[model samples]
Target chain A: MKNGIWVSKNGRVSEASGLQPRDALLFAPHGMTSEDLLQEQRSALQQNIKLIRTRLAEATRR
Target chain B: MAKARVFISSVNEDGLKPLRRSVFRVLEGLGHEPLMWEENLGPWPSYQNPVEKCLEAVEQSDLYLLFIGTRGGTFDAAAGVTVTHSEFIRAVDKGKTVLVWADAETKAIFFSGIAWKLDEYIAHTVQESGSYPAPMQALDFLRSCQEAPPHIDPYVWLLLHDIRQRGIYVEDLARGVETDWRGYFSDLLRRGLLLLPLEPTIAENSNRLEEAETSFDLLAALLPQVTLEPPHDWKVWLNTIRERLQGRTIEHRYGRWNRETVGSYEACNAASLYRRDGDSMRFISCCGRASAVRSFALNDQSSYIALTYAMGPRAEQVYYTESGQKFFYCVRSGPFVATFHFPAGSSWDQLRYIRYKDSVVSAIIGPNTRLVKLVRLLLGGMRA
Candidate 1:
């Protein structure tokens, strides 16, 4: 049995699924785990970094 | 004609109340009928199809006014079924006119509820100038509308009117290369194409114009043209040259020939000749060590050369030599043609030979020898 809370579209969280202390959370809204969120954030930051570098290069060229 | 009907859509009632009222007053003042859902809808209407009637009303109206706020909640909940969101969507779908008023500060919050993918639909975001939020600033905005002398920028208004007649992709129009009316209009006119009316505020228009002007000015300065007068039969002469060299190609080269002759050369398997009306003769040659073709124009007994060169390692050189010069000489290292004024009675001995090579490798050639050879090549050519 998966242990984590279930998050609905409206952001309502339900803990119906039961199972252990260290088990991974499952079925949270879009099925995104904490790690997934962190990864997404990391990716967004990297994209922003790339954009900034490109802008800097353009500015220097000018 | 019946006064145009307008429907105002807003997500946050409190934030938009004042705007809603002002909009109503403005429409009424203009002798147009203005309607808002809160004012028009019956109390506690079934949520099942809360937006159905609004969509219907929007369809009947000539224009739809959208007030975008930043917060999400009931607005997002009712998005698919609310009078505001649905009405705007339906109006757009029906090809009705749309005027979007965005509360810049609140836009992020308002849009947060919407899926990020749908954000593109919300274009034309403008910051409100007043100190307060949408509701607080409505009165001032209304007053400004009233006080703003009836003198709308006719050009801007004309664009708006055209937009109404033929819908446009707002995002594309706003982000076009020529942001100002003049440049935008010039581009449109030059292309012989008509664009839909979509007017930015005066400030936005001016800012865009300035940016475009600066960019074009810089480009023009970097590339200056040397003008020449053509012979009376220049065009025919050029055509004859072209006919003679129709099948051959040319190659371009750039390098230092000797100590002082650092420049570029263009050689071709075939050459085309042309004459302009001002008695100018043009020679075009293709196929060389480089990919660029060279064009030589002769006017007033002087020759002007123009060639394109690669910016990187395989760059070309350009040089000029006068007739009777002993050694060929170079003028520049990049892809450019330099014009040489032939000294009185000077012959081909002053002419120079040009070549192309890698910049790093070409640096090894002595400059003095290059210059001497350049003059000699020119003199030799003139004698030949």
Candidate 2:
């Protein structure tokens, strides 16, 4: 059987059947592709950066 | 005149202590009678009919003050019929003046409840600065009302008076002005007019009518601007709202994915831009374990989008983004797939630019991997 991943409805991640433990270990089951995860992380990081910049601007104004 | 009666309703016992005391003191100071369930109820009545008495108190009161706490009981919980909820309903049913106050914490908790959620009461819930003791907040609400001159309920009165003052007459109000002109004229009638023993001549009535007409003209010009401007330019409208709400001291932040992120060459390589139009943009991005897709409009009006994954669980949020942008994203647990949708009024060229960026990122990560090939095909279709 092809090794796959499974993500539970509540966002829990689990490995699918037939994959090697190593490959399974590398994969996450929450149904998010690796690319999607990276993009979301980047989006969050950018938001944090904006927040920090806004805070700094406010501090400087004060 | 008889003292005004007030009913106070709250969910939290611990938080109610100080607020209860403060409300009691303030109302007493203002020569009013203040009633609270915990302080005034002799005991939870054995008879179910006791609820009727509570409703009666609410009906008799000049004002009903609802104190919404951060936590009390679930709406679906057996204790869901909280005093606050009951009093609110009773006050509404009886057509009493009801005031509602809640803080952010309470709002979150209140909204989460299944039974009587905050959204059900949003029209009545007045957002306060923070979770102060309920009684003190109640005192503040009372004092604010006292400071304002006796007028019709502010929101209603403002709408009615402003609409009349602006000269833009609704058919209903125009009829009211014609039939029982006395009822409409009473508000404009001054104390000076009443003091005269003799009835005013036609000239005096004409003068008053002219004054009202001028007032209406000023209101018609200004009120519509106040009502209409915000929907046209939402960004400026939101900023104005934020400014007015600064005293509430709650941070309201909204963010949008800019062209650099959405239209990057890297993004195009990783995602597929499925649809492009003047106001709508749609695309899908995929990686090893997950995929995300969405549709949104440039003008940020009503739009919906969804993403599902091959491996991981999917989640969805439907919300409007800053700058009138709206979209949705979903991801798989292991591989990466992301999709975006822009609606009929959005800038499709901007989406194309984002697809281009994603393509660049795919090239950098893996020159000709299967995932990269898939991304290339997706972007190539967009170009075609």
Candidate achieving the largest lDDT: 2
lDDT of 1 by residue, B1-384 (tens): 455577877665465566677657666665668877667654445664655666777888867766554322243332323335455557766767576655443333223432121111111111123121232133233234432223221122212222323333322212112223234324534542232222124334545655764674464444333222433453343233223221111222211111222333221122122222222323322211222323333222122222212112112222222222211111222222222211111221111111212221132122222232232232223211
lDDT of 2 by residue, B1-384 (tens): 455578876555565456666666666666668887666754565775556677777887867765443343223234234444556666766656555544334333323441132112221332233222232333234335432233222222222222222222232211112233234224323542454333334335545655764674475355434322113432332233222211111111111111122221112111222233344444433332224446544333222221233222322221112232322222222222233222212432322322232322222232222232233223223322
- Candidate maximizing DockQ: 2
The Cα local distance difference test for each model comes to 0.35, 0.37
Give Cα distance to truth, residue B22, candidate 2, Å: 1.3
- Off-target runs (Cα >4 Å) in candidate 1 are A1-62, B44-49, B73-83, B107-384
Give the lDDT of residue B280 in candidate 2: 47
What's the chain B TM-score of candidate 1?
Answer: 0.29
DockQ, model 1, C-alpha based: 0.01
